[model samples]
Target: MESIARQSVKMCPFMQRAGSVQGLQVLHNANLPAVARKCPVVGHAMSRAYATASGTGARRATAPEPKAGSANEMVANHATQESLFDYDGLFETEIEKKRLDKSYRFFNNINRLAKEFPKAHRDLEDDKVTVWCSNDYLALSKNQQVIDVMKKTLDKYGAGAGGTRNIAGHNRHALKLEAEVAALHKKEGALVFSSCYVANDAVLSLLGQKIKDLVIFSDELNHASMIVGIKHANTTKHIFRHNDYDQLEEMLQMYPRSTPKLIAFESVYSMSGSVADIDRICTLAEKYGALTFLDEVHAVGLYGPHGAGVAEHCDFEAHRLAGIKSLPDKSVMDRVDMITGTLGKSFGTVGGYVAASQRLIDWFRSYAPGFIFTTSLPPSVMAGAAEAIRYQRSHLELRQLQQLHTGYVKQGMKELGIPVIPNPSHIVPVLVGNPDLTKQASDLLMKNHKIYVQAINFPTVARGTERLRITPTPDHTDDLSDILLDAVDDVFNELQLPRVRDWESQGGILGVGESDFVEQSNLWTEEQLSLSNNQLNPNVSDPVLGNLEVSSGIKV
Candidate 1:
C-alpha cells in the first residue's frame, strides 16, 4: 500500500524512468485496481513534465516504444527468460576440475574372498590383479574359526538386530564382545558403536557439549570423524601441529590449571605412517592436568604384547627391557583416560568401541544419540568379532610375520631406488609428487603388471603429497615381494619419478641402518612374547581352535 512516488524514489534511475507507463501497465495486468488508482497522481505529474511544445499549445507526450530487433527490445526479452535451475552444477564442476587435474578417484572393482588372503587375486575385467593396499592387516576376516562362529550365530539369530538397543536390539554376543574389548584395553568398561567413526563422533560431541567450560586440544591431523564431533559440539578447540609436543604445551599453558581440557590424538597417522610420541604426550597431559583421549584404530591388533595397541606395547617394552617384575608406576595406557579403536581393520569385523571408566561409558551409553538411536550390530558380527579378537590376542606368529614382511618390503624398495616415505610404523608409502604421475603409475602397475595399489590424492592428503600406500602382509612371499618391487621400479622409471638419495652415502631422511632394522624385527619377536607372558593369562585357550604353541621363533 506504499505510494507510487515513494516507490519511485527507492528504485534505480532506469527503473524510475520506465515505471511511469510500465509500472501502471503491470498493475493493470495484475488486477491491482487499488494500486493503479493510487498511481494516477504520479503518472499525471510525470506526463506533465514530459509534455512537448506544439503549434497550438503545449501537449502531453507519449513515450516511444522500443523497436523490434533493437538492443533495448532484446534486453527486455532476455530479462523475461526463465533462469537455469542447476542444483547439480557444483558437483559437476568439482568432478570436471578433478578430471582436469588427474586427481579423480576411480574405484577398481575387486572381487575376492578374504580366506584366499594375501594369495587371493582380485578379479578384474579379464585378469586377476595382485592387491597391495588393504587395511585387513592379518586377513582375520577369512579365518575359518571366525567364519564358523559367524555362520552358527547367523543360523540361530537370523539377520538384522530387530530394533535399537533401547528397544530390545541388544544381543548377548555384543555384551560378550564388549567385555572382551574392555579386558583387551585393560579398562574398567567399554561401549560398542556401529563403527569407530560413529563412536568418535558421538563421544566427542557429547563430552564437548555437556562438560562445563570444556576446551578441546586436538591434533591438526586428527581423523574426519573426530573433526565432525568436535565441530558439532561447537566448543572452543585448539589444534596443535601434528605430533608437536612443544606447540601443545604452549597452548595448554595459555589456559588456567582449573580449566577442563581434553587432549585428543591418534596412535598412528594412517597416511604418513608416523607414530605419535605417546609417552611424551602423556607426560604433558599429566603436567597440564588434562584428560587424554587416544585413538588406536590403526595400531590395535598390530602393536603391544597382546595386540592391545602402542600404548600397552611401549609400557611392556619399558618393563621387560628393564627386567622388572611389575609394570612401571604408570604406563602410557594407564595415563590415558579413554581409548577408541575399530574392529574392521585388524579384527576383520565391523564395529568400533570406546574403552574407559564405567561412569564415562555409562554416560555415553545413556546420552550419545548416535548410539542410542541406531540399531546394534547383528549377533553374527559380534560373535565373529569376539572370536577374531580372541584368536589374535594369543597368536604372536601372525604379528611377527607381518612385521618381518614390512621390514623386508621397505628394505627391498630402498634397494631398488624407490622413494619410500620414512616412518617407524609398519606402513610403507611410495612418494609420487604429481597427481597425474601418481595415477599413471597406479594404472601402469595394474594394467601392465597386474598389481593393484590405489593412488591416494587430495583431500586425503595435500595436493603435492599424493602417493601409493602399501601394506605388506604375511601372505606376500619373497618372490611376490621381488615382483612388486620390480614392477614399482619399472613404473618409476617409466614416469621418471625422483628417488630419495641412498642412505649409506648421502645420509638421507631415513638414516636407519641394517643393525637397527634387525633389532626392531627382534623386538617384535622374542621380546614381545616375553613381555606378553607377564600380563596375559597363560592358561586361557580357545576350545574350538585349541592352544597355539609359540616354539617356532619369528621367521620371515
Candidate 2:
C-alpha cells in the first residue's frame, strides 16, 4: 500500500507558471469532490485537473519560447537582477571611472625571448617594443641553465603535482629547493608557497592569529599582501610613516614589552626604489621585544654578496668595512625572525618562500591552510628555482652590471633635467604627478618611441604620485639606454612636464650643499626633507649611498 502511494506521488507532474496560479485558485474554490479534496494526494490531483481546465495545455502549445542572443546572455540575464544587485552596472561605473582618470591597465601580450633578455623586444601591434618595466632584474628567467633543469625535471616527473604536500605531492625537488633557500638565508628551515604574496599572507595570518596579545607594527607603504594578512588576523596593528624610523620607535614604545609584537616591512620598496633602514629597524625590534618579519622579495637574488638579501649584504659590508659588529647577540640576517622572498622576480622563476627557525616552519606547515590544502608546486618549478638560486649565488658580476645600468640611467636622467626619484636602490621612477599625463607619457613611449614603461598610479602609489617606473637591467645596453632617454625627453617636451632641479648654476652637480636642488628634487615631501638632509653623506662616492652626489653629464 505504501509503495503504491509513493508511486502515485512520483507520477504527478509540477505545474507551469499559469497552471500554478490556477491550481492555487482551485484549492480556494470548492469545485472538486469531497473525497478528492480531503485526501492530500487526491487534492493534488484535483488541482492538476483545474490547471488542465484553465487552458494551461493550450498556453504551453501556443506560446512561443523566448529567444536569447546567446547562451551566456540567457544565463546572465536569468541569474542577475538589477533590483537585487547590479553587477554589470557596478562594472560599467568602474570602467568609466578608470577611463576618465586615464588609469586603465593595458596588458601587452609579450613573446618570450629565445636568447636576448631584459634587452629583448615585445610584440605589440606588429612592432617590436623594448620593455623597461620588467621585474626579472637579473634576466635569469631566460637563462639556459635554469631552462635545461626545468625541461629535464618536467620530462622525468611529468606535469602537475598529483596532490597536496601531505599527500602524494611531496617530492625530492621541493625538499631540495627548500633546503637551498634555507641555506641561502642562513635559516634553520624554509617552506615554499605558490607565491611570495601567499607566503606572506599565510605566515602573517597564522602568526597574528596564534600569538597572545599580538600587535603588528607595519610600514604604511607595505605591500597589499602583508596588509591583507594583518587585517584578516583581526589583531591590533600600528602603521608607521614610510621609512621613518623615529615614528616606528615611537609606536613601539607605546606597546608593552611583554606583548608579542611583529614589525613587518619590506627591504626594498618596489615603486619608489627606497631601501629600508633594516639595521635600525632590527635594533628597535630587539629593544621592544618584537619579532621582525622582513619581506625581501625585491632584494633577494639582486643584492648581497651571495645574493641572499639586503640584510646579508648589510652585515657583510659592515663587518668588512668597519670591523664593528654592532649587534652582539644576533647577526643581521639572524635579527630578522621571518624572511619572505620570491623565486619570480630576480630569481626568474615562480613561487615564494618563508625562511625561519625549524619550529616556526613546522608550525606553518602544520597549521596554514594555504600550504596544506593547495597542490604542491610542480617538480619542474622547484628544480628550476633551485638551479636559479644556485646560479645566482656565484654570479656577482650580474649584480654589479645591474647596478651600473641603474646608475647610468639615473645619472643620465638627472643631466637631462628629468624629474627622477632619487634613491640608492636599482629602481628609477620618473614623476608625472598626474594620472592622465603619466598614461600619456607611457603611451607615447610605446607607440612613438617603441619603449614600454608601465605607468604606476593610484592604489599602487598615491593618486598624485603617478609616475613611470623604469627598471634597467644588465642586458639593457648603452645604445638602448640612450634611446630610452631621448624618447623620454621627447615625451616630456611634448607633454610640457616639469623638469628636474636647477642645479646647473651650482656647478651642475646635485649634492647636499645645493639647498635649491634638494628642495626641487621632489624625492621627498616637506616632512621628509629634514630626514633626507640628515642622511645625505656628501663625501660618499658609492652609488648605493643613501645621499650621494650626482655629477652633471655623468655617464657609465
Candidate 3:
C-alpha cells in the first residue's frame, strides 16, 4: 500500500518538478549517469582514456527518467502575479540587514603586507606599498603601453559612458571587445558584466529566473558571489562537496530528471589555487541535460592554450588575434556566448565583462539591476584593459619569467621544511596551522625581518587549516629569497621549535597538528614569561636589584 502511494506521488508532474521524493522536496532536479559514456561525442575521449588505464570499458551507466508529470507544466501552474515583490517565506535572516564583525574581517591583506615591508616600496608604503601582493600578473596597472592606450581612448571618447549599454554606452569599442572575447572562447555570443562578481551574481540570478523550473548544482567551494546569486534564485540548489565527482554524481542520480539543471563553477579557485576538472563537469551536465556556466576569472589570462580556459586551452588555440590593432573593420561581427573576466588581476585594470550573445546582452542590459542601475566603466579603463590583454599575448617571455620566479619560491619553501600544498599553479601557500599563531608569525616577520606574507584564516579557509599565503612575483629576486629563508629560520629557532628539517627527516607531516604547526610559531617562550613576571614583582627578584647601584646619594 505504501509503495503504491509513493509511485502515485512520483507520477504527478508538480511532484516531480518540486523534486518531491518520499513526500519531501529535494534540491537537484536531474539524475545523471554514473559514467560519462551517456554523452558519446563529448565523453569519447574520457572513455578511451579510462579504458586504456583500466582493464575493461564494460561498466554500466544508468540515469533515471522523469515521472509522468513534466517540470515545465508544474512551473507554469505555479507562477505568481506578485512573485517579483514576494519577500515572505524566503530565507530572510540570510539576506535581510544582517550584521557582521567588520572590525576584524580581512578586507585587504595586500595593504597589510605593504605596511610590513616598507623598504621594499617604490613609493609611500603607508600610502602605497611597492610589494608584490597584487595579482596584477600582466603588470598592466603600471605598464606604459596600457597607460598610453587609456590616454588615446579617453581623448577619443571622453570620460564616462553617461548611460547604460542600451543607451549611449554601447560604443564601437565595446562591441569589438565583446566579439573578441567571444572569439577567444569560441562561443556563439558573450556578455560583459561590470565585474566578475557582478557577472556571476547577475548571470546565475537571471538564468534561474528565465528558465521556468531550473535546478542549480553548484560547487561547494564556489566564490561568495556565486553563492549569493544561487540564494537569490530562490529555487532548489544542490552543493556537491569540493571536487568530489562521485558525490556530485550520486546527488544528480537522486534528483528528479524533469526540471532543467544548471551547473555553476569556477576554473581556478583564488584562495586555494586548485584547478577544476571542467571537461568532466561539462560531460556530466550534458548527460543530465544540464547547461554549464563557468567562471574563468583566475584562469582567463593563464589557463587555456590561448587562455580561453580549461576546455578550450586543452583543445587548441581557438582564436588568434591578427595584426589588427583597433576594434573591428566593419567585418567579423557575429561571435559566440559570453566568457566573463576581470581587468584587475591579470589585465591590470578595474572592470569586468561578459561575452555572450547579442540577444542575451540586450536582455541583461535591459533588466539586470547591477548593469542597468550602476555607472558604466570609464572609456580609459576599457582602453587600458584592451591594451593589457594585447600586451600579455605579445610579451610571453616576461610572463614566463614571472612564472619561473613563482616556481623558485615554491621550491625554496619545500626545501626549507614548509608544508606547501602541491599544485603547479603560481600561488603557493605555506600551511601555518592555526589562526592566532599564523597572525603572530606574520607580525614577527614584518617587525623583525620586514618579510611580509598575508595570513589567511577562517572562513576563508576551514578552521584549523590557517596558512600564510605567500605570493612570489618576478620582482622578488633570489637575494630576497635568501633573506626570507634566513629570517624564517631565525624566527622558528627563537620560538624554541623543532627544526623543519628534523621533522621532515622523521617522515612526519609538518603543520598537520597544533603542536607541530601552531604551538611552534608562538613568539613568547616560558623563560621569557618567567623573567617578565620576576621584573614586575618587586620583592620576588632581589638578586638583580641588589647588584644594581643606587642613583641617589641615599643608597640602601
Candidate 4:
C-alpha cells in the first residue's frame, strides 16, 4: 500500500506533491500513539517520504497504540523537515510549473473557432432542423392546450411554490394534483417527488429499510435511478436478464416462499421500448406473496383504453383491461397496489409520483430523505402538470397521431435497412455497433441534414449496442420522416456500415411476412390493426377474436 501510494504521488502533479508534503508534516509532530491509532504504515511512510525528499534526518515509524480508542487518536504532529527546493527529482513532470503557468489555451481555441469558423458549427435552429432527441412521447408539452394551461397557472400562481410541501408550500393545487395522479393510475394515494429519479432512488431505499431481509429481484435493464435506490437500501439484490420473465420466476422460486421479496421493473423500458410480461409477472408476485413495483414512466399517457398502463390493461388479463371494473376511475375505487410515473416526459413538466396504499404514502412522507431534504415542487409546475395530464387524457386523437408517427418512422427505417429493436411503442432506436460511428452519425445528421438524434452510449447502453435514439412524437409531422430516414442512409453509407437484416426481410424469408405474421394487438397499444400495432409488440391476441388485416389498416 505504501509503495503504491508513493507511485501514485510520483505520478500526481506538483500541487498534489505540496499537499502531500503538508499532510506529512501534520503526521510527523503528532504523538506516536496517535499516529499508530489512525494508520501506522500509511502515516509513517508518508512522513518518511517527505523527510527523505527534504534531505532531513532518517525518519522512523511511529509506535503502536495500546488501545483502539484513546486521547492520542485525535493528535497529529508535523515537524518542518523538507524545504521545497530540496525536493528535486521527486516529481520529474514539472507539474507545479504547468499548474502555475496556466493559460487559457483550451478556452482560447474555442474563442478562435467561434470567430474564424463562425459558420462551421453554426446553430441549426436558423436552418430549420428537425429534432427527435427529447423523450416527449405524446408531444403534448408544446400543444396549444397544454401550453395554455401552463400559462394560466403561471399567471395565477406566479413562479415557484415557495416552501416545502409540509410547510407553506402545501398549496391546494399540489394536493389536487396528487389526487389527480392517484385517480389517473387507479391507486388509493399518490405522493409526488421532485423528480422521477428521486422517486425511484428514495422509495426503494425506504422500502429496503422497512422490509426485513429484503431480496430485490430487479430487472437487469432497470433505469439508473432504480439501481441507485436498490444500492442506497443496501440490501441483497438479484438482477434478472432484461424482459426474461421465466428467469425472474426461477429466481423467485429459489427464495423461501415467506420471505419478503420485491419484483421491480419498468412497464415501458425507455431505451428498448420493450414492456414486461405484466400478467405473468403479476401472477408470480401473487403466488410468492411478493410485492410489485412497476415504473410506468414511458407508458402512463399512451396505453390502455384510457392510458392506465399495461399491467392493468394489456397483460394476460386482456379481458380485464376492457372490463368496466378495470377502468381508471373504477379501479381506484377497487384494486391496484403500487404504480410510479414521471411528470417530465409525457406530462411536459418536471417531477415524479408514486401511487400506492395510503399507508405507503404516509411512510414515504416521513422516511424518504429525498423528499425531506429538498423543497417541494412549485405550485405552478404542479398545476401545469395537472393540466397536461388532463389534456393528454382527453386528446385520444393526439395519442393516435403519435402512434401513427412512430409506425411510419419505424417502418421507413426498416425499409431503409436500419436495424431497429422490435418494440410495440413510440420509442424507436437504430442500433449502431460502434460508439464513435454512432456519435459521428449524430453529428452528420445535425450538420449536413439539420436533423438531431442523440447517440446513446455506455454506460447508458451495453457495449456494441450503442444507438441513435429517436423519439417520434405526435408533434413530429409525417412530412419530416423522409428527411430523417434519408439522412440515416447517407450517414451509414458514408461510414461504410453494412445493412443488417430486420424483422420485415427476415419475415419474408420465413414465409411469414404475408401469412402467419398477420397478428393483432397485444397489451401495449389500444389500437387494433394500426401499423404500429403489428409485430413490434410480440404479445399478440388470439386470431379467433377478430379478422385483423396486418398488411395495412388504421384501426382508430
Highest lDDT scorer: 1
Off by over 4 Å in 2: 1-82, 119-126, 317-329, 502-556
How do these models rank on TM-score, best leading?
Answer: 1, 2, 4, 3
Candidates 1 and 2: which is better by lDDT?
A: 1
* TM-score (C-alpha) between model 3 and the true structure: 0.64
lDDT of 3: 0.57
Residue 484 of model 4, lDDT score: 80
Model 2, 376-488: lDDT tens digits are 88899989998898777666567767777887898889888897766777888888778989988988998898788888988798887788999988888788899999999
TM-score, model 4 to reference: 0.72
Which residue pairs clash in candidate 2?
none
Model 1 Cα lDDT, one tens digit per residue, 1-556: 2356447546735436646566545434443322322355654653444453232465534335455335553222222222446869988998999899877889887764565555435543445777788888877888899999999999999988887778875667877787778767867678888999999999999988899888999998899989998898789999999888999999999999889889999998898888788888888888988888899999898887567888877876553343212344766787789999999998988999999877787778778998899888889998999899888877766777778788889999888878777777778888876788888899999889988899989878888778999997767778888999999999988888767643334343332322233222322555553443334444334523311111111124
After TM-score superposition, the amount by which residue 124's alpha carbon in candidate 2 deviates from its true location, in angstroms, is 6.6
User: Candidate 4's residue-wise lDDT over 18-136, tens digit each?
Assistant: 46653354344444434332454565776667667855566644355435345545564343334436456646446554334321011101110212111122343234455676766
- TM-score (C-alpha) between model 2 and the true structure: 0.75
State each model's CA lDDT, in order.
0.76, 0.75, 0.57, 0.66
Residue-level lDDT for 105 in candidate 2: 78
**In TM-score terms, which candidate is top?**
1
Kindly indicate the candidate among 3 and 4 with the higher TM-score.
4
